[model samples]
Target: GQQVMQIPQYQHVQEGEDFTTYCNSSTTLSNIQWYKQRPGGHPVFLIQLVKSGEVKKQKRLTFQFGEAKKNSSLHITATQTTDVGTYFCAGEVTGGGNKLTFGTGTQLKVEL
Candidate 1:
């Protein structure tokens, strides 16, 4: 069975500090997508990486994909209260429609 693993269900950081979380899948993933869920809010799409060894950045946030497409990481350079949220990684399975399975999720807490 395929599985997605994530670490640090919760994380706290001081303002101006850095934070990072990792995601991994038991089976090789065809494509991966990252989502963010704000407190008391639903998940929102952040980014997706399809190619092996792909990397992308959004402002203070950076995302990376493993060469095997089975793992990924997200790094935030500076922590802020506005950066508080849960980051999730979803993978697309070979079979079925929109079979987007999500990771356990990394809850991020930024202190001011």
Candidate 2:
């Protein structure tokens, strides 16, 4: 079984500051998916990274996949109250098919 873990289990950032969460996998991953879950809400898919060393950006958010394919990171620029949520990284190991191992998650708090 593969394990996925995220660092900085909790993060607090002032509005206009930046935030980041790092995800690491026990085994090489074929692909990784990022999700955001607001308080009392189910996880919602945000983006996916497949290629090694891939980098993607959506608005003020940035995502990067390590060249080793075993780690990934999500960064938010200029944090806002709307950015408050738990971020999760789900990894699908090589040959694991559609099964995904989800990380413990990183809870983010933003305040003015």
Candidate 3:
């Protein structure tokens, strides 16, 4: 079974600080996906990485995939109140049935 693990399960940052979360898989992944879930809100798909060593950014957020396709990372340039949420990484293992294993998740809290 494929398992995804994330570090720094919880974070508290002052507004304007940078934040980052890492995700790793027990097996090589066919694809990696990132999601954000705000307090009292459902999870929202942020992005997906298919190619090895791929990097993508959206506004103040950056996402990266390891060359081996077994790890990924998400970084936020600046912490803001709106950025407070739990970040999750989901991965699909090679040859594994369409099931996606999600990481433990990293919770971010921004103080004004």
Candidate 4:
């Protein structure tokens, strides 16, 4: 079975600082998705990547998928109090059912 792993399980950033998180998969992934979970809130889909070596940006945030499609990363240009939340990366394993395996997740805390 394929598994997804995330690094820097937790982060503490001062407001206006930058933050980043990395994710890797044990096997090639068909596609990968990113989600954000605010404190005391449910997970919310942020973006999805299907092509190798793909990169996408939303405002001050950037997402990247590795050329091997086995790794990914997310970077935030600047940290804000509102950015305090957990970021998760999920992917579908090769030949796997329509189910997704989620990484451990990176928890972000921003302070003023």
Candidate 5:
């Protein structure tokens, strides 16, 4: 079975600080999709990167596609209470019925 995991499941940061989280998998994937969930809300689509060596950013957030497509990362330049949420990366398995498998996911909290 393919496995995906993310480091620093929870992060607490002061306002205006920086934060980062990493996602990894035991097997490669065709593509990966990232989502963000508010403290008490459902996940909302963020972005998707499919090509190796690809990178995309929205405001202070950055997303990277691994060279092998087996790993990915998310970084935030400056933290704000508004950034508080859980980040997830979902990938597809080689031969699984489901097209998407999720990472452990990183939860971010920004302090005042």
Candidate 6:
């Protein structure tokens, strides 16, 4: 069984400050998916990183995949209240078929 873990389980940032969360996997991953879950809501797919050393950006959010394909990170520029949520990284092991292992998650809080 593979596991994915995220650092800084909880993060508090003032509005307009930058925030980042790191995710590491126990084994090499074929792909990784990022999701955001708001309070009392279901997880919503944000994006997926497949290529090693891949980097993608959506608006003020940036995502990066490690060259080894065993780690990833998410960064947000100018944190806002709307960014409050639990961020999760799900990884699919190189030969694990369609199964995905989710990380412990990082909860982000924004304050004015």
User: Best-fitting candidate, measured by lDDT?
Assistant: 6
Tens-digit per-residue lDDT, 21-88, candidate 4: 99999999999999999999999999999999999999989999999999999999888898899999
Which digits, one per residue and each the tens of the lDDT, describe model 3 over residues 2-70?
A: 679999899999999999999999999999999999999998999999999999999999999999999
Predicted structure 3: lDDT: 0.95
What stretches of model 4 exceed 4 Å from their correct place? none
Give all candidates' CA lDDT scores. 0.92, 0.96, 0.95, 0.94, 0.89, 0.97
Candidate 5 segments whose C-alpha is farther than 4 A from its true place? 94-98
Tell me the TM-score of each prediction against the true structure. 0.95, 0.98, 0.96, 0.96, 0.93, 0.98
Clashing pairs in 4: none
Error of 5 at 41 (Å): 0.7
Give lDDT tens digits, candidate 6, residues 1-112.
Answer: 7889999999999999999999999899999999999999999999999999999999999999999999999999999999999999999986677998999999999999
- What lDDT would candidate 6 get against the real structure? 0.97
Error of 1 at 53 (Å): 0.5
Q: What is the C-alpha lDDT profile of model 2 across 1-112, one tens digit per residue?
A: 6789999999999999999999999999999999999999999999999999999999999999999999999999999999999999999977776998999999999999
lDDT of 5 by residue, 41-91 (tens): 999989988898789999999999899999999899988898999999888
Q: Which wins on lDDT, candidate 5 or candidate 6?
A: 6
- Select the stronger candidate by TM-score from 4 and 5: 4
- Error at 65, model 2, angstroms: 0.3
lDDT order of candidates, top first: 6, 2, 3, 4, 1, 5
